[model samples]
Structures are given as C-alpha cells and as structure tokens.
Target: VGVCVIPIRYIGRKMLARARVVQSSQGDLSSTLQENFSSQRDIRAFELEQQQIRLFRDRIRRYIQASIGAVRWQSLLTPLIEFVSAIAMAATLLVGNMNGMNMGDFAALATAMYLCYEPVKKLGAVHNKAETLNAGLERINHVLNAPDDVPEPENPRSPAAWKGEVEFRNVCFGYQQDSPVMRNIDLRIPSGQVVALVGPSGAGKTTFINLLCRFYDVLSGSVKVDGIDVREMSKKELLSHIALVSQYPVLFRGSVADNIRIGRPDASDAEVEEAGRMSAVDSFINETGEGYSRMIGEMGEGLSGGQRQRVSLARAFLKNAPILVLDEATASLDMKSEEQIQKEIERLASGRTTFIIAHRFSTIRMADRILVLEKGRVVADGTHEELMASSPLYRELYNKQQMVAEEEGGAPC
Candidate 1:
C-alpha cells in the first residue's frame, strides 16, 4: 500500500495539470473568437466553450477520485489480510488442540501479523490525502499573499492644489529587469500648456504616461506635480486633480446620463445634459430617441466606437479638472465627431495642463509643444515646425502620419 500511494500522487498531479490546461485553452479560444464576432455569435461561441471546459473538468476530477478510491480499497485489503491471518491462527489452534500443542503461540502469531500491516496501510492513506491537499493549498496562498510591485507610501499627504506643472527628473524605468523602457528623461510641462507625446509603438509613450500617474514607480528618479514628488501624494488626492481619456474608454451598464455622472457623481441631471450638448452628444442622444435616458449596455455595447469616445469626452468635460490626459482619445472619431470633440477638448485645455498622446499629426499640430520619445528617452522637444526642421525622427513620424491621413481621403497633415 505504501509503494502504491506514491504512484497515485503522481497520477493525481498529472490529472490536475491536464484539467487546468484544458480549462484555460477553452477560455482563450472563447476570447479570441469574441474579438471577431457579432454579439450573438460571440455569446453562442462562449457558451459552447464553457460547456466543453465544464465537462472536461468534471471528468478529470471523477477519474482522479476513482484512482484514490482504488487506493482506499487496497488499504482496506490490510483488514482482509488480518482476517486471513486469524483464520490461519484458528487452523493452528485446531491443530494444536488435536496434537496437544500450545494455543497461546497461535494467538501471538495473529496479533503480530495485524500490527505489522495495519499501521503501514493507515499511514499510506493519510499521507496520500495530505500530499493532494498540500498541492491545492500552495496555489491558493500564492495568489492571496503576493506583494504589490507598486505600493502606496506609508505616510502620504493630500495635495491641496495642483499648479498643473509636471516635471520628470532624470527618470529611468523598465517593465523588465535591465532593459530600460525610458532612460534619463527630463521634461518640464508648465501650467495651461497643451503638450503632445508622439512616438511609435514600444517607444515608451504609454510608459511615460504611466509614470506620470504613478501606475508604476520610477526606478532611479522622480515625477513631480506642482513641484511635489508624486510618490509623496496620496493616490486619491493625486488622481482627483487629473482626468484621463483613454483610446478604449470603459463605460458601465447605465443610462447616458448615468455614465456622464461618473465624472462628478453629485452633478445634477441638467449639468449632465449640458456636458452632452458641449460634446455634441445631445444630437445623437436625441436622435436615438432615448434622450439622456438611453441605456448603455455593458462597456457601451450598443454604441459605436465614436459614440463611446464622445461620451468619454463628455465625462471629462463634466469632471472639469485642472489637468487632462488624452491617450489617443480622438483616434476613433470621424472628421465631424473629431471636430466637435476637439473643440470641447481645446476649450477645456485652456488654462489647464493637458497631455495629449496622439498618432494623428493633424490633431497635435496645434499643441504648444511636442515631446518626441524614442526608446524611452525624450529625443526631441519643440513646436511642430521646430521638430520638423531639426529632428529627423520627428520628421519621419510626421511624414508617415500625413501619408496615413491622405490615404484616408483627408487633406495632408
């Protein structure tokens, strides 16, 4: 039984790995198909994948338990081994009585046999269960006790006001160990200035923004807002002074009014509607016949990408913060929607520090200054005309964006 238990433990672990892989693969397939299908088709594919994974997991669990059950039966066989020894003892007694031999010798032989097998069998069963449970407990603790890579400061101060000055002092950072994403970066953004961050993918545009928001800390330097190190400020206090609009804006399941209200929860219905009007959202909201009361399903499911972006812009307008960060906020909008949203953003950017991360050269041509990042370092910093005149890399990116805009049947940038 002790030897058999070793094999059972190995088999159980193999089954557990197989089950985990099967479940994970099914989930991956569902997510991949979801990216390409309509809502109805996505739902059907997800349901089918879910069913297959559930059946596969149940079968694996049942098979592993059945293997355990067989080991348990093998363990119970030790009792039967004892019963056999007893019968042998009884035969010895009968023979002893018939031949006038000792009965005490037979009883002693039976007791010794039981003691040899019983403890080993019970110990095997106990060890088998303990090993299986230990594997499960190890996985649970790993997720629960993992430390945060970015932690809040122990004694943090709330920022009373942000003068909207952002500074990066010799910042160095990387997602991986040794390969720096951004290195030796120094930047100064004054209050009420619109600055554009333009670079190719992996050129550290997003990483720069992450550093500003303190999503990830710098390795060897610091980011300061209004002359105060961002790390010294509480997360909530730092965030309240900034409004961010992402390329993919996440809208909850609620009415259009409710979505705008997220920016300022205490805002009245009339204020929400005013934001919509400012973003030209009122036209679409009224046209859809739902007015402001129209529902936006999970993640703004029923709205077009442009529409969702407009709503997000409206939320930013409603927030009315001293600083705004736009991460390709207008990348999805049509010319008309872009024009409307750009107008609102420009209006909002007045007297506020705005960081615009844009791939479209046409959008950022009006930025007060553009910071060109390459391999996580600021290689060029100037106005559009100045960068085009001085930096070859900036010129290349500007020319590429102009070509793209021309291909889209628009005037060249």
Candidate 2:
C-alpha cells in the first residue's frame, strides 16, 4: 500500500505544474478569439484574413497540446496506483504463505488492505481535481490582488464653491517615469472661457486634459479646480462637475433613451428628449420610427459613426456640467451634421468653461483662445490671427491643413 502511494504523489506534482500551463494557454486562446471578433472590419480592410486564421489555429493547437499534457499526467495517476496495488496484494499473499499464516488470518489481512486501497485511490482522484481548481484560482487571484496604481485620498475634500476655473501649475507627466510626454506646462483657464488645443500628432494635447481630469496624476506640480488641488478631491466629486465627449464614445446595449439618460440618472423623459433634440439625435431617431426606444447594440453597433457621436453629445448636453471637454467631438459627422452640431456646441459652451481639442482649423475658429503644443511644451498661446502672425509652428500647421482642405475641394479654414 505504501509503495502504491509513491507513484500517485509524484504524478500529482507533475499534473499540478501542467495544469497551470493549460489554464494560461486557454486564456491566451480566448483573448485572441475576442480580439478577432471585435476587429472584424479591420481584419477585412487590411486583408489579414489568412494571417488571423493561421494565428488562431496556432493558438488552438497550443491550447490542445497543453490540455493533453495535463491530462496525460492525470490519467497516468489512476492506472499506476492500481498497478501498484496489484503488486502489493501479490506480495502480501506470498509473505503470508511463507510465514505459515492460516487462511482466516490471511483473509482478514487482505480485506483490511483492500479497504485501505479503495480510500487511497479515491484520495488520488480528489488530489487531481484540487490541482486543476488551484490553477484557475491562481489566475483569478493575480488580477484580484494587483496593486491599485491610482489610490484614493485618505481624506477627500470638496470645494466650498464649484467654479469652472481650471489651473495647471508647472505640471509634468509621463506614462513612463523616465520618458515624459508633457513637461513644464503652466496655464490658467478662467470660467466661461473657450480654449482650443492644437498641435501635430504626439503633442501633449490629450495628456493635458487627462491630467486635469485626474485620469492620471502629474509627476510634478498640480492641477486645481476652483482653488483646490484635484488630488485632494474625490474622483467622483471632481468628475461630476465636468462633461467629456471623446472622439470615440462607448455606448452599451440599451435603448437610445437609456443610453442618453446615463448622463443624468435622475433626468425625466422630457429632459432626455430635450437633450436628444439639442444634439440633433431626434432627427435620426424619428427616421427609424422607434424614436427614443430604438435599441443600440453593444459598443454602439447598428448605429452609424455620426449617430454615435450625436448620442455622445446628447449625454453631455443632458449632464450640463460647468466644465465641458470636447475631444474632436464632431470628427465623425458630415459637413451638414457638423454645421448643425457646431451651433449646438456653441450654445452649450455659453457661460461654461470649454476645452476643445481639434486638428481642424474650422473647429478651432470659434475658440476664444488657442494653445499650440510642440513636443511636450506649449509653444504658442493666442488667437487664430495672432498665432498665424507670430508662431511659425502654428502658422505652418494651419497652412498645411488649409492647403489640404483646398486640394480636397473642402471649405478653407
């Protein structure tokens, strides 16, 4: 019986190690499938059908191999235990005969050994199950036990007055510690001001807004809303005062009205419809005949890009926050739609602090002030006319865009 247990224990260890590999390979295969599913359009457009198919096949093969390896060890455990038990029984019978034991004595001893063998076999099966379960739990715990990079404040503070004034004092930040994306940024945006951020790609325009929103903390200096440092305020309270409409907005599976009402959960049906109307969402909803009750698929599927942009704008309108951030809010719209939404955006920006991040000079024309960034620093801060005359970098960017618009037979900025 003791000799029988040795092989089971050794094989159990091998099963445990291989089980981890199987779990990891299974996760990798699942992630690849999800990525391919979500990016079907890109896959077709890039003509990568064969490549993706091959990659998926390789992952499947790896997953199968890992599974087989784990099973090999597990399957060996039961058979090896049974084989050892047979040898143990044979050895007991031979020893009993050599010792001149009576048949009754030998039978009793054999019965006890058989009962013990049954439990040992059952325990070996249980051990195999336990190792497989442990592998999955380890993966889950890896995520659950990960450290939070953005920790909450020990004592959160709220502003006595919620003004729209935003200030960045010598702010510096980077996704990586040694390589800074934005450096020595200092600016103050007063309430009711409309500021446009423009630059060539890789400039710090998005990073500036990210820091102000506290999506990431600045490595140096501070961002202040009203008179309080944003780090001192709770994330929820700070975000409540700002409305952001990104280039690509995410909409969940729900009715159009339900998606819009996410801006203000307590908003009435009338208020939601009003917001939809303000953002020109009502026009298309009416065309569909379902109006506000029209269902939106996951990630705003089954809706055109322009319609998704309008829905996102509707949310911002419903929120009516004091601070508005539009990151290429109208980029997805056609000329006619852009014209209509531009008017709505102007109305929404009235008496609110607005920050617009756009590459289109037409979009930035309405901005009271424009800040041009180069590399990681603000290179120019002035109106359109002032920038064109004084800042060569800004002049070159605007002129290039203007020339492209002319070549494309679009209206000049």
Candidate 3:
C-alpha cells in the first residue's frame, strides 16, 4: 500500500501543474474566439479574414498542446499505480511462502490486501479531479478578489429632494495620478439649464460626463449634486436621478419593449409604447407588423444604426430622470432623422438639467450655454454666438465642420 502511494504522489504533482496550464490556455482561446466573433463586420470590412484565421488557429494549437499534456500526466497515474500494486502482491506471496503459511491463510491475506489497494487506486483518481477543480477556482478567484476602483460609501445619504443642480468646485482628476485630464474645473450649473460640451477629440469631453456620473472619484476637490457631495450618496441612488444616451447604444437580445423597459423596470406596457412613439421608434417598428413585440438580435443586429439610437432614446424617455445626458446621441441618424429626434429631445429637456456633447453646430446651437474644452480645461463658456466671437478654438472647429458639411453637400451651420 505504501509503495503504491509513491507513484501517485509523484504523478499527482505533475498533473496539478499541467492542469493549471490547460485552464489558462483554454481561457485564452475562448477570449480570442469571443473577440473575433463580435468584430466580424470590422474584420470583413478591413479584409482581415486571413489574419484573424491565422491568429485563431495559433491559439487553438496552444490549447490542444496544453490539454494533451494534462491528459498524458493523468493517464500515466493509474497505470503506474497498478504496476506498483502488482509488485506489492508479489512480495506478499514470497513472504507468506518463506514463513511457511498454508495456502488458505495466504489466500485470505491476499484478498484483504487487494481490497485495501482498490481504495488507494480510487484516491489517486480523486486527487487528479481535485487538482483540476483547484485550477478553475484559482481563475475564478482572480476576478472575484479583484479590487474595486470605485467603492460604495458605508453610510450613504439621500437628499430631501433631487433638484438636478450640478457644481464642480476646483475639481482635478486624471486616469493616471501624475497626469491630470481635468484641472481646477470650477463651474455651477443651475437646475433645468441646457448645457453643451464642445471639444476636439481626446479633449476630456467623455471624462467630464464620467465624473458627473461618479464613475470615478475626483483626484481632489469635490463634485456636488443638489448641495450634496456625490461621494456621500449611494451610487445606485445617484444614478437613479440621471439618464444617459451614449454615442454607441448597446441593445440586448429581446423584444423592443423589453429593451426600453430596462430604464424603468416597473414601467407599464402603455408607458413603454408612449416613450417609443416619442423617440420615433414607432415609425419603423410599426412597418415591421410586430411593432414593439418584434425581437431584436444581440447588439441590436438586424437594426440600422438610427433605429438603435432611437431605441436608446426611448429608454431615456422612459426613465424620465431629472438629469439628462446626450453624448453624441444623434450622431448615427440621417439629416431628417436627426431633425426629427432633435425636436423630441428638446421637448424632453424641458424643466430638466440637460447636458449635450456634440460636434455638429446644429446640435450645439440648442444649448443655452456652450462650454468649449481644450486639453481638459474649459477655454470658452457661453452661447454659440458668444463662443464664435470669443473662442478661436471653437470658431476653428465650427468652420472646419461647416467646410466638411458643404463638401458632403449637407446643410451648413
């Protein structure tokens, strides 16, 4: 019995190491497949089919090699234990003969030894299974034990009322500690004001909204909503008061009604339809003959970009939050679609604190206040007419956009 355990222990260690490698390689293969599947359109558009195929094949080869290594160690364990057991049985027989034991006594002793060896053999298999389970747990724990970059407050506060008033007081922040993306940002926005953020690419436009949503804590100073520090409020509670319509809206595999109902889960069917109608989703949806019941594919497949944006807009309308954020919300729409949705957006923005981030002058013109940002700082803040006169950067951006629109035979600002 003791001799049999020696081979099991040695092979068990080798199996454990190989099992870890097998799990890691399997994860890599899965990640590659998921990414390739999700970006199929881009792959075909850029003529990257062969390159992607080669990459996937390489990962598959590595996964197969790792799996074979683990199997080899596992297969070796049982056979080696069986051989050790045979040697032990032979020794027992020789000892019994030397001590002059009768055939019946030797037979009984051999049966008892065989019974003990059977359990030991099963233990080796159980050990191998245990190692495989441990490897999977290690991977799961890596994600489960990861640190939360933004943590919830222990004792959260709720305001008496939500007024949608936002203020940034000497706020400074950066993705990295040493380099600041936003510096000394001090601004006060009254409730129910329509504010627009204009900037060149990488000018911290998205980051500015990210901070207002409390996606990340500021490096210094504070951001306040209705005279309450955002850090003191529960993230869930704070987010409940705001609705965001992003540039690239994500839709799930469900009916149109289901996606819109995500904004307010308790919303009734009639309410969902009303919101959809307001956002112009009803126009095309009714043409399908299924209306709100029409099923959507993953990531809004089978739907045009404009249709997807309207669906996202419906969600925001259904939410009816006091604060509204439109991050290039109409970017995917055609001129007519943009004009139509722009009207609904204006109606929705009434009596709500609204923030718009857009490059189109037509959209920027709707804002009561336009903030021109450059390198994370607000270089200009005023109405569109005010910025055109005061801010060179804002003027240059508008002029360039005007030229591009003219070249494309679209309406000029």
Candidate 4:
C-alpha cells in the first residue's frame, strides 16, 4: 500500500489536471451541440449548416486530444505502481534474511507480505477508477466551487404579504459592464395595476423582470416590492409574491396533479381541480380518463402548447400570488388557444399587479398602463391609445403588427 501510495500521489498530479481539462472540453462540446440542435431550423434557413459543422468538428477534435492526454497519464500510473510493488517485495525478502529471521518467522512475514499485496492491488484498481471518474468529479466540483452571483442574506426576512406595488429606482445593470442592459431606469406601478412592457428585441424587457425577481444583483440602484428592496428579501419571500407563466412553460415529470400542486404544495385535490377548471384545462384532463393522474413528460412534452400554458396558469391561480408576470405567455398558441388564454389571462390579472412581456399588440392593448422601451430606456408610458398618439416607435411597431395580422386574415383583436 505504501509503495502504491507514493507513486499515485506524486506521479498522478498531472493526470488529475489532464482529466479536468478533458471534462471541461466535453462540457463545452455538449453545450455547443445543444445550441446547434435547438437552432437547427435557423441554421438551415440561413444556409449556415456548413459553418456550424466546421465549428462542431473543431470542438470534437479538442475533446479527443484532451481525452487522449488524460488516459495516457492514467495508464502510466498502473505500470509504475506495479514496478514499485515488485521492488518493495524483493527488498523485504532480502532484509528479512539479513536480520537473521528464523524459518517460521520468515514464513509468517512472507504471509503478511502476500496479504499486503491484496490491498495494494485493490488500491491500484481504485486509482484507475479514480482517474477516469475524476472527469465527472471535476464537472461537479466546478459548479460546487463557483462563487454565487446571487447569494441569500445571512439573516433573511420572509414577508407575510406584499401589496405588489413595484418600483425601479435609478436602476442599471449589464451582463457585461461595457454594454448595459438597463440604464438609469426609474418606474413605479401601483398595487393591482396591469402593466405591459413593449420593446424591440434587445431593449431589456426580460432583464427588467429578472431584476424584479432578484435573479441577479443589480450593478447599481434598486428594485423594490411594496417599497421593500427585493435584494433584502429571502428567495422564498421574493417568489411568494409572484406567479409566473413564461412563453415556454417548463413542466417536470410527474402526475398532472403533482405538477399543478407545485405552486401550493398543501393544496387538496379539490383545490387543484378548481384551479385547473379556472384555467380551462379541467375538461381535457377529465376526458383523458386520467383526471389528475395523467403523467406529463419533461417540459410537458406530451401536452399541446395550449395545455402546457394553461397548466402554468393553473399553477398561478392556485398560488394566488399578488404579482402576475406573463412573459410572452400565449405567443406560441393558435388563435383559438390564444383567445382562450387571453380570457384566462385577464381573469388572472384581475386585482393583481400584472406585468406582461408579449410583443403582440392585441394581447397588451387592454393593459391599464403600457411602458414602451427603446435602447434600455422607457421612451413612452401610457394607455395603448395614448401611446399610439404619443410615441412614433410604438406606432411603427403597432402598424407593422397590424399589417401582418391583416395578411394572416385574422380580425383585429
């Protein structure tokens, strides 16, 4: 064991480093694969398949080089350990004879030495396993050792209730310091008001909601909930006041009942059913003969787009949080489904401070207040009619959207 230990520690340091490199390369390659697959349609439409393939092949080659380097070091350790064990055994026999050991004593020492070989062999086997598994270990340790970008307070306060009045005070942020996502933004929404955020693709609409949820610490300024700084509140407190229905509703692998119950774990069967009914999914659930027993695949893969959206809405209904945020919530649905959800969305927004981030003019037209953003600034704030009269950007976006609607032959909302 001693003979094996010395070589494994000293000779294996470089091997561990190589193993980590291999793991990181594999991770990078996997991430690239996921991105490429998710955007395959865009790549094909843009005729960039060859470009993507070239990049992917380059990543794969790097992964191959890293794997070979790691394996080479691990393979070297096993032979070196065997050579040291053989020498140690020979030295032990010679020393025993020179020290004048009797035959019986020599035989006993010989038996002990043989027993030592078993553990040393096992240790060598363990070393090989460790060398390969270190690749996985490095992946785990990277996440574990990473510094938290958003950390909880040492002593966190969970508010019992929030009035849902949101305030953004001189707020600013950037994923990179040189390019700000939101800039010196100041806004206030009264409790229970329905607000719509309209902006060009990169005008920080999503970033606003992220800051509101305290997903990242602001580089400067503060976002408040009911006059309390969101950063000061615990995660539970921050989540309790908001019920979110995103553009793509992500569901876990569970019975339909289990998924709906996630919003309020203590909800009874009747409560879950009522929430589903309100969200317009109860009829379909009962028709499938599964009622609440139906199991959904990951990300609700088996369900229709409308069904998934309603499930998320059902979750919000059950939670009954004071703040409702629907980020492109019904954008993927068909006209029929969109209309159904729009009614549900209105019901969901009633008497709650609701914020929506859909680009469709029809969906946001009824909002009590609309904030038009451009280049990280709120360029206009008003009711839809007021915005149409006041903001050229809003008018241009609305006219383009109306033309598209006309071409699609759908009546104006």
User: Please, what is the TM-score per model?
Assistant: 0.72, 0.94, 0.94, 0.80
* Model 4, span 236-267: residue lDDT tens: 77887899876667899998889999889999
Residue ranges of candidate 2 with Cα displaced over 4 Å = 1-5, 404-413
Quote the positional error of residue 201 for candidate 2 in Å: 1.5
Query: What would the per-residue lDDT of candidate 3 be over residues 1-413, giving only the tens digit for each residue?
Result: 77877878887788888889889988989999999999999999999999999998999998899999989988988788878878888988899889999999999998998888779989998988898888889989999999877788899988888989999999899999999999888999999999999999999988889999999999998999999889999999999999999878999999999999998999999999999988899999999799999999999998999899999999999999999999998888777778788888999998999999988777766789989889999999998888889999999999999997788677786
Off by over 4 Å in 4: 1-8, 21-138, 158-161, 283-289
lDDT of 1 by residue, 1-413 (tens): 33444544554555445444444454555565454353555557667657655755666665566556545544554455455556655775677688876668766765775575666556545654555466556566888889977677899875566678999999999988788999999889998899999988789988888888888889988999988888988888788788888767999999999998888899999999989988778878898798999999987988988889888888888888888999988888887677667777788888999999988877786699999999888999999889999999999998888888888887676
lDDT of 2 by residue, 1-413 (tens): 66866787787788888989999999999999999999999999999999999999999999999999988888888788888888888999999999999999999998998899888888888888898898899999999999866667889998888879999999989999999999899999998999999998889888888888899998999999997899989999899999999867999899999999988999999999999998999999999799999999989999999899999999999998999999888888776678787888899999999999988777777899999999989999999889989999999999898987687576887
Clashes of 1: 0
What TM-score does prediction 3 earn?
A: 0.94
Stretches of model 1 off by over 4 angstroms after superposition = 1-141
> What is candidate 1's local distance difference test score?
0.78
Which whole-number lDDT from 0 to 100 does residue 319 have in model 2? Answer: 96
Q: Cα lDDT of model 2 overall?
A: 0.90
CA lDDT of 380 in candidate 3? 93
Winner of 1 and 3 under TM-score? 3
Deviation from native of the Cα of residue 273 in model 2, angstroms: 1.1
